[model samples]
Target chain A: SAVISQKPSRDICQRGTSLTIQCQVDSQVTMMFWYRQQPGQSLTLIATANQGSEATYESGFVIDKFPISRPNLTFSTLTVSNMSPEDSSIYLCSGSGRTEAFFGQGTRLTVV
Target chain B: AQSVAQPEDQVNVAEGNPLTVKCTYSVSGNPYLFWYVQYPNRGLQFLLKYITGDNLVKGSYGFEAEFNKSQTSFHLKKPSALVSDSALYFCAVRYPGSARQLTFGSGTQLTVLP
Candidate 1:
């Protein structure tokens, strides 16, 4: 299994501001995904980040609101734009390989 | 659309007793089933997966799941429960041969009491 990590385990931000969450993997991987877990809810896929290309957003998410950057196979970032209280949730990153799926610690964002 | 359903919102079991967490899925094609566990403030950890071959798949932390294709269910099981097993359990599924994405169940909180 791969070891994945995310920076700024948590943060509190004011509404209208933006916050970028970073995810790093121990090794290069082919599949990297982002997900959002709202309060008392199941996780929802945000996008699939492809190295050197644009991320593929899921049905309810758009690039404008959740811009993603993946410069390489082991690193990616998700920026939440124009934050609102509703944006408060835990953001998780996952990487998939032939054997197992590994996830990062996750970033807990609180928008006030 | 592909989706998973964890019938029980929570499962309570006494330590040293057997346990089972039920899961059912719906998908257009054959599904790749997986079970994951999450501790408080921690990332989801891979428990086990049923890609092919065996009907029973063993995973990390002494966990196993039985895949019943006829019933479209993959329920997690353990011979003996532990207090440490208390956590959120999630069942996920992906369509066969597709890296498209995984559909997750609502999740079940498993609490093992001493």
Candidate 2:
């Protein structure tokens, strides 16, 4: 299992502001992904963080709203742009190894 | 597209009683089933997974899941429940040839009573 570290474990941001969450893995991984868990809801996939290319966003999400950067195999970041009250949720980063997947502690964002 | 289904939204059990959380899946190919536990305000912790070669697989925290191909189900189970086991549980699935992104079901909230 890979050890993932995410920064800004909890943050309060004003509406219309943007906050960037960083994820660092202790070892290199092939696939990295971003997910969102809304209040009292299950997780939704935000995007796939490609190592050297643009991140692939899922339906109902776009790069303009959730831009991602995967500089290398061991690091990635997800930035929630132009936040809103509805954007308040827990953001998690996950990495998949050869056999299994692992997750970070997650960042809790509250938009006010 | 692959999908996962957790039939129950919440399950209540008393301590020392066997507990079960139901899950079913749909996939075009061989399925990789996984169970994860999430505590309040925390990320998911991998409990167990069924890759292949075993009908039943055991994992962390004494959790085990049985994979039934005929039923297309992988249900998480524990012999005895504990108050500490109160948490949200999620069932996830992935196809072997797909993008490797896991499709998670709507989680089930498990509450264990004293």
Candidate 3:
């Protein structure tokens, strides 16, 4: 298990605006996962961030809408571009080892 | 592909009584199952996980889960329920070749009446 944290515990933004959430892990990990949990819904993986390479987005998600960046093994950032009301959700970042995965505190984004 | 399913939307238990939250999963290969609890406005906390060895695995917050390979189910249990244990619970699973990316269930809201 690793200590993980996310910046801006929560934020409220207007539609058409974008926000970037940062994820920090205390220790290095091989792979990091990004997920979106809509209000009162299940968690859906947005992408898998790889160190020194582009992220692999899941079906129904795109890099243009949810761009991801992993500069290193311990940190990554996700940007929700052109936000909409439907984009209001908890953005969670997770790090994975060979066996288990650990999550960050999460960023609660509310789009108005 | 690996996936998890939490059949119940919510479960209610009386204080000091045993509680169970049911979960089932599907995977192409062997499964790695996990349980997590989330309090209101808080991040998810790991409850327990079943990797390879034991059918019953214990984890933080006095929570434990049993893995039933035949039925492909993993149910979260607590011997005695507490009011503080009321929260949203999630079941997650990952299979080989997924690189440890877990697929989480919708979640089960558990309420312990005092």
Candidate 4:
């Protein structure tokens, strides 16, 4: 099991600004993933943070909007660029293990 | 492509009663499934996973989930509900052959009323 620690547990940001949420895993993992959970909604997959190359994004989500970086197996970051009120949500990061994946506490971003 | 659905948004169960949270999956091949629980003001914690073999899988805090292939369902169950068991439950699925990431369900909020 890996413990992922995410920075800036909760932050209120102004519109048009960007916030970068960092996650650090206690051990190495094969893949790192990012997700978004809006108010009263389920989680949506943002992207898969690859260690060396560019991240793999899901449909409706683009790299420019949610840029992800995985410098190593145990570290990754997701930046919410050009924030808006709609972008206000909880951003969570997870590390895929052998069987079950572990998630971080999540960074709650509120854009006003 | 691959997805899981938790039909119910909210489930209320009285304490000491059995509880079930329904989840269904749609995929091409075999389903790699997982269950997670998010307590109030906390991150998601892995409850259990069903990769193969066992249909009834036990997990943390006396929680268990039954995997049904015929119905394409994996419902989380607890014999005796506790007030602390009240939380948001999420079901996740990974494609057996191709996909690298897990598709998550919308999530179900469980309330174990005292």
Complex DockQ per candidate: 0.66, 0.78, 0.76, 0.77
Docking class of 1: medium
Can you tell me which runs of candidate 3 are displaced by over 4 Å?
Answer: none
TM, chain A, every candidate: 0.96, 0.97, 0.96, 0.97
Candidate 1, residue A19: the lDDT equals 96
Evaluate fnat for each of the predicted models and list the values in order: 0.51, 0.56, 0.59, 0.69
Interface RMS for model 1: 1.5
**Model 4 lDDT at residue B11:** 100
* TM-score of structure candidate 3: 0.97
The candidate that wins on TM-score is: 2
Model 4 error, position B108 (Å): 1.0
Candidate 3 residue-wise lDDT, A1-112, digit = tens: 7788898899999999999999998775678889999999988999999888889989999999998999987889999999999999999998877777888889999999
Worst 10 residues of 2 chain A by lDDT: A24-33
lDDT of 2 by residue, B58-84 (tens): 999888999999999999999999999
Report the number of the highest-DockQ candidate.
Answer: 2
Clash count, candidate 3: 0
- Give one digit per residue, the lDDT tens place, for model 4 in A84-108: 9999998999888766788999988
Give the clash count for each candidate: 0, 0, 0, 0
Kindly list the per-residue Cα lDDT of model 4 for residues B20-108, writing each as its tens digit: 99999998788889999987656788899999998999999999999999999999999999999999999999886744577889999
